[model samples]
Target: MNCEKIKGKVSIRTVLESFNLFPVKENGKTGFYFALDREEKVPSLSVDYINNKAFDFGTGKNYDIISIVQQINKTSVSDALKYLEKFNFQPQEIDQKEEVRSNAKYEIIQVKEVKHPALVQYLKYRNVCDQIHFVKEIHYQINGKKFFGIGFLNDSGGYEIRNKYTKICLGKKDVTLLKSGMDCQREVKIFEGFFDFLTYRNIQRGANEVSDYLVLNSTAMLFKAEELMKKYNIISLFLDNDSNGRLITDKLFNQYNAVRDCASIYTGFNDLNEWFCSSGRYCDY
Candidate 1:
């Protein structure tokens, strides 16, 4: 696609999120993100969602979506467009409707085994196809339009649905707890998201099934797992390597006795799945 078409279809927020750069604070339609080039105590990049542009107060540099990608990837315009092509984009009108009714009602259409070719490919891409039993194919509707994603069910019957293009929660957001079927399970592994949990299972190759597993689905739901976490003698955290992950790890360390941060295993990567996919260990289970 041309630069204008890409700029029109993709949002500045989406590109930042793809690089794991999240806003430290948001005000109305504008978000204050950290400067992409350097580390700082406070955010100096102002991203305008409505206009899909970003301005860096630190360097006084302005960026549209394409330029943002170019800057972050340190690539030419052609390479940047190629990188942006991997993202799934919808029409501007649909994005506007989605933003306006983000909290609107949704209906679960169906839940079945992961069978669709697209979702299967997604699982393969994440290198978690061996753990397909842990997830399902979910079809849900929002604003009378139908969509499907690989669904990981939470304890509250809600689903953490994810596809190549979208990530959302259907029903009440909550945590997912998987017991080892042992009568006296005292160990639990905590993961920030289900994909990481699946990656762990895949890496272990079914050898580490003795302990219970808890997928937070989102770190924002950490509180929901606290009461359950109290019962475990060992709590191993497989959270991301981002600022939020470090903050949550520190919080849990202060609150619990045997909390272990396992992020060191995936040291330079953002999360476990990303590490697994890039570590040249994408072998079949």
Candidate 2:
């Protein structure tokens, strides 16, 4: 069968399950699956069964059934099609309730200090326990199920929630800009995620230099930071060592003379947190 016929016959959920991948959370026709390319504590890949498509929030990439197969198998389109030929099944139609439930709202039940043992352990695992004061213990409910996570607040009052097995946003998505409160703070450090920011703080413990911080939260929100970024004299980036990170870094460099790619500190690893967790060594800067 051709690609279009195969896509029409197979569901995104079927392709994901063929690889032993399952959703950590689901609401009606939408399910949140773990990323196909990386190992993450929380699921960041949102799969739409009704549309037979998936979107990875972490990488900001959209995938259809064929692309999802290619990503998971690291194969070409032809190879992906050949591999998918084995899973010939009819697609199921989603009902109206499931479609409406896909837009179900999540309620923030409570937000408090990070005192839960599990959350504290998660911080220690990421080597950011010392930065606990920067995050909160968030209790939220989605689809009538209670859940909690370590939440990092953004400028728009939304929380970037992370836990041992969950990663989600509680409200509107936006970049988080933190000020140093210095008389003339010109230097600002940019991180792709809050963990990297925490890792930077953990690495810079006991340092006297004061600088502002901006966490993009997601690379898709990079444009939202442009106005705020203009105020800084020095912009050091601690983005991941991936294509998306490099692309954004290059974009900033071309746009602003103050931009600096600091991923060299963790040369061989994916990001700052990965480098610290693997080597337990601190950056000299």
Candidate 3:
């Protein structure tokens, strides 16, 4: 493969090839460049030649084209290639339709079809004992699954959990069960994940009244502000007061009636799960 003499014998040909980037050579030697598909464009990293070495301006480090391409491939291949096109290189127009990709299930993993009575007991222990019990149902899907580690019954009367990279829809029955167990109607409680919801249930058992529960599996979902606002009368957001969490809460509070910040009680903790485990409050449970 022919390469461009950008600096320090850096082989542009090798870098593009490793990233599956094919180069279009002109007049056989002086000019070598590649055409990129639409999905291959990424502007995060920039390449510059200085002192005869290829330097990556984004990371502020000098790299051989091969090493740079390898690192880009590992991180986000789509974004990496766009950075390369910053030079006078031609890019190929790829149809967005072919960009089907899968990502990892970061939160939960499915081990087997094994059913454990312990999960049921754990649910009951959390004071989520509604007339309708939720049996543990586990299955696998090919698109990969998000461990979600969290889920909630939306006002639309549906259950939602995060799968590998997307949200999986739950049946209305599950949502009914969650709503039945929740004590919040006028009052509200916000939680980051399902386990925190369980923890809160366990703590609030002997308390006077139960508040409505809202589980925001990922704060990013809160961008759908209308989803939560239309359903509840008194809305309470139980979000960590950190940068991202606070950002979501502030945005929602603006359009909603009332928003409560539980982390104010213990600013040190990030979320309810962290608080349950660390805050000396729920030590008994």
Candidate 4:
């Protein structure tokens, strides 16, 4: 494809997301991204999805979606086009309609406070037995197959279902918010997954710290939670030890001055839950 064709076929938002340079959704077709060509404390790259173009004030440069990718990766035009080819860009209206239909495939059968034996064992194996109160025993059917898993509710009324053999989401995907009862500075803890939240609780047992919790369910969902999160005076992140987590933490740190990364506590493990499980077996079975 040529320049205009390449730009029109690829969504800049998708391209940036593929690079893990997530941008906040501004409105229908416009979103603000961090400077792709320079270091910035704020988002200076404005992307227009409808127009398939972007302009970065940090670098005083205007570009189409292809040029943005080319700039960030320092790749040639042909290579950048090759990278953009990985994403299937579609009009937002059509994509949303199809997404709703696709999301309808999963049926949530029942959700209640955790009480299932197998789920209890699964929590135990993850070293989060005491966290049963926060999660639900979820029974769901997908693609004509019935399955059960531990479910953590997200802000958009979706459930992040997780079990030993399966992981999926039902309904709209969003972040999970857990508010600590006691009052404190507007400090909030951010976790990549609900299991990490449970692990943090297990590790910080008896502390009874009053802090808000935000679980993105997936690192890609961090941008979805950024608006409400900006109110916090301090942001503590307990993400996994993966590259995606590191990139997100770095982004949050740069954007929010008070952001603190607590990943050091579980430096050797993949995530907080892994570290918690490695500590000891607190199984009830």
Candidate 5:
């Protein structure tokens, strides 16, 4: 079983039974192990001695390997193999490093042409016009494709778009489903991007109540929040506490009513996730 499945079924007894092994307990589980040792006096096998398929137990903890074999009743070799496969396990460690892409130049590597039917459905759901420009980039690597770039809505504002007199690419943002309208919810929370919104969702998992979510695709779209604010009773702005973020928040608060800035909660760090990780707080938020 995978770790999640194992955890789901695990109790102390169930765990021991699963391995056909029992702990040599003393003093209510606080005791040293009494088992046969190797030449170096190391326990020959133990629960800790886990491998790709099942764990081992130290000697003197007499266990019938056949008992386990019998417990998994399979009529054929293929069936037995299938049953055993679920118990297979592997131990691995991986370290990840962040590679910064500073001034990285990329060609219009490739375009993912969206099928018209799906594109129409998506645009309809977002209340976006059909003529709003759309394109997706497919990034490639030596092995194969690396990442699929986000499809964006063109806003006709960026330097490249201005030169071409066409719409600028405004990267796609997810629309969160609120249980109720923002005005009736009592608390409205805003995020600069969908990633930030999702990170906030992770941090606030199992929270007492679900708050309203508003994701502004870019700082330039901060003005768009005015219409949403008119409909919402309480607006909580969680913009990045950076200069641009602050400028956007100030502008929104000054021009719109019933808007409050909560970005100050993470003033030390430039972004919410960074601040949350660095704060050393007990809660994820």
Candidate 6:
């Protein structure tokens, strides 16, 4: 399983319990009793189940399951991740009510060519219509109500669903990989989301300017792209200017000497789509 899947699906309480370390309560809230620093009368490590996160009151350190695993075992990230895989914490199956609700909650009703005027305008609004023909219109239902969006399928068969009022993934999350018609292309281009890929296509205007494409959908999904990217002679990054973007770009930069950070081209914008919008119709994340 991928890091995001493990971090999200594995409960830290389960991890703590498996390690034979139990949490203690002081002020009526449940919390762990681990000592990250000097021991004290009150237990300092607290697990927040609502957020699926933890915090060390002593050191004022916040943690996710992966980080918590690293803390407990003093192990590296990859090792902690492997440690998590042994747990068999499959993503809990969508329970009965949820099965019904998920059926009702934007269940895909239909998918077809990008012919919706609203989605067409949404793309034109983002200035990415040059590649409009490649996208699809996804019609779904939630609570017996219907909705639609422009959809792009990623490598794992998940749809990156986006509309003016909403943005979400409809299935398993994964990166979108677009190959150069010829295999072993010397270079690849990276973007944080599919719109950025479309934005790049809109700017570059034709197939000649395009290289292989990797649309991460979420910056956190960068790890899934790392192995495939190593095959290229050059890698150009068009990630957002935000913290997540800078951090992942740094990780990619370290491993590949030939990787290039291309965000400088849209210096003040948060991302390629935002730059393309230029305060156009969609002001989004």
Q: Backbone clashes per model, in order? A: 0, 0, 14, 0, 2, 1
Q: Per-residue alpha-carbon lDDT of model 1 for 99-189, expressed as tens digits?
A: 1112335799999999999999999999999999999999988768799999999887878788876666777666799998997767999
TM-score of each: 0.65, 0.67, 0.43, 0.64, 0.38, 0.63
lDDT by residue (tens digit), candidate 3, 91-140 = 13222122112121223334332134543344344334231122233343
| True-vs-predicted CA distance for residue 151, candidate 6, Å | 0.6
- CA deviation > 4 Å runs, candidate 6: 1-106, 279-285
Our model 3 lands, by Cα RMSD against the true structure, at 15.6
Q: Which tens-of-lDDT digit does each residue in 144-185 have in candidate 2?
A: 779999999999887888887776666766789998889776
In order, candidate lDDTs are 0.78, 0.77, 0.42, 0.71, 0.41, 0.70
Q: What is the C-alpha local distance difference test score of candidate 2?
A: 0.77
Judged by lDDT against the true structure, how good is candidate 4?
Answer: 0.71
**Poorest 10 consecutive residues of model 2 by lDDT?**
93-102
- Report the candidate with higher TM-score, 4 versus 6: 4
- Give candidate 5's root-mean-square deviation (CA, Å): 23.4
Show the lowest summed lDDT stretch of 10 residues, model 1: 92-101
What is the overall TM-score of model 2 with all chains considered together?
0.67
Q: Find the 10 residues in a row with the least total lDDT in model 5.
A: 91-100
**What lDDT score is found at residue 230 in candidate 2?**
83
Per-residue lDDT for 16-107 in model 4, tens only? Answer: 64454445436646878767765555678888767777888777789887777678778999987766543432212122211111123568
**Where is model 2 more than 4 Å wrong at Cα?**
1-104, 281-285
Error of 1 at 170 (Å): 0.6
Write out the backbone clash pairs for model 5: 1-86, 156-168
Which has the higher lDDT value, candidate number 1 or candidate number 5? 1
Candidate 5's residue-wise lDDT over 1-285, tens digit each? 343343332222222323222233323222222232222223233333122122335433432222233333424544433333322221111011211111212234445544445444443333332322333333322123243333432233211111111112222212233344333566678877544554565566567764567765444344334555666667788888654566566666765678888877777776775665564543211
